[model samples]
Target: MSSILRELGALVIDADLLAREVVAPGTPGLAALVEEFGPGVLTPDGELDRPAVASRVFGDEAARRTLEGIVHPRVYEEIQRLEAEAPPGAVVVHDIPLLAESGRADSFDAVVVVDAPLATQVERMVRDRGWSEDDARSRAAAQASREDRLAVATHVVENTGTREDLRRRVEEVWADLHAR
Candidate 1:
C-alpha cells in the first residue's frame, strides 16, 4: 500500500522505519530503553537487539506498554514533523500496523486497510519471511483481528490474490483517494 501510494506521489510516513530510527544506537530513545530494560536489549556492539527486546516484551502486557511509552511519542513527533513538511494537497499516508489496536483509526482523514486472510498471512510469514508456522500464527494472534481492522477501514485492499491483482486494487484505491 505504501509503495503504491509513493508511486502515486504521496508522502509516506512508515511507522516501522520511524520506530527503528527513534531507537537507533546512541539516541535518547535507546538510552531510555536501556535504562528500563537493561543491557540485554543491546548487541555486543551496543546496537539495539530488536529480537532480544521482543523476547522481553512479547507476552507481557506491562512490558509492552512500557516499550510503547518509550517509543511511540518519539515516532509521533517525527511523523508530525514529516506531515508538517509535506507539500499542500499532497496525500500523506501513514503506514501504521496498529491503527485500530492503538485506538487511532479516527485520527486520519481516511483509513485504507491492505488485508489478507489469516491463513494467507501465516503462509506468507512462513514461505516468504522464513518464520515457523507457529511463530507466524502467534504473531498474527497478537494483532487486531481481521474483523477489527475491517470495522475501521474506509477502504479495504484485499491482498488474497496475485501481485497484479494487488496493483490493480491499489490503483483503484488511488483513484478513489483522488476523487475525494
Candidate 2:
C-alpha cells in the first residue's frame, strides 16, 4: 500500500480538479440534505443564497438542528470515504474553514492555522473581494475567534508578511511534517 502521505499528496495534487459533486445525485445523504437545505450552503464561490439560507435556517435555533441534520452526515461520510481510500498512515488534513464553528478540531492529528492580522485580513478582503468593512468583519467574526484558533493550533503559520515569506514558511513546515 502507498503511504498515507502519498495518498494525501495525490489528493492535494488533484483537489482543484475534483469537481464539486455534492450537488449531484447518488451522493451521500448529507450532500442530498445540504442540497435540500440549501444547495451551495458551503460553496466558496458565493453561489449560495445567503439571505435565503439565513431566513430559512442559518440564524434560528430551530434551523440549527435542521442544518446539522443535513450537514453532519455528509461531512462524516466524506471523511469516511477519504479515510478508506487513503493509503496507510496518510495524514488526512481536511481544510475545513468552519472546523472551529463545528467544534471538531479534536478529531485531527494536528491543527494548523494560518492567520494574518485583522487589519491585513480586512484590507485583503475589502481590496480583493470588494467587501464592505462591515461585511468583512462579519465574515471574520462568523468563524472561530482568532484566540480560539490559536489556542487549538498545534502549529501556526503567521501570514502577516509577504507571499514569498509565507511560501517559505509553508515549505519549512511541510518539510518538517514529511520528515517526521
TM-score of each: 0.96, 0.68
Q: For this target, which candidate reaches the highest lDDT against the unseen true structure?
A: 1
lDDT of 2 by residue, 1-180 (tens): 112324436233221112233323445643555656756554455444444564565345666667556556566666667768977765455656666666888886666678887888899999998877877886676567888888888778888887777777766666666655
Model 1: lDDT of residue 7: 92
Candidate 2, residue 119: the lDDT equals 86
**lDDT computed for candidate 2:** 0.61
**Cα RMSDs of all predictions?**
1.1, 5.9
| The 10-residue segment with the lowest total lDDT in model 1 | 52-61
Clashing pairs in 2: 4-90
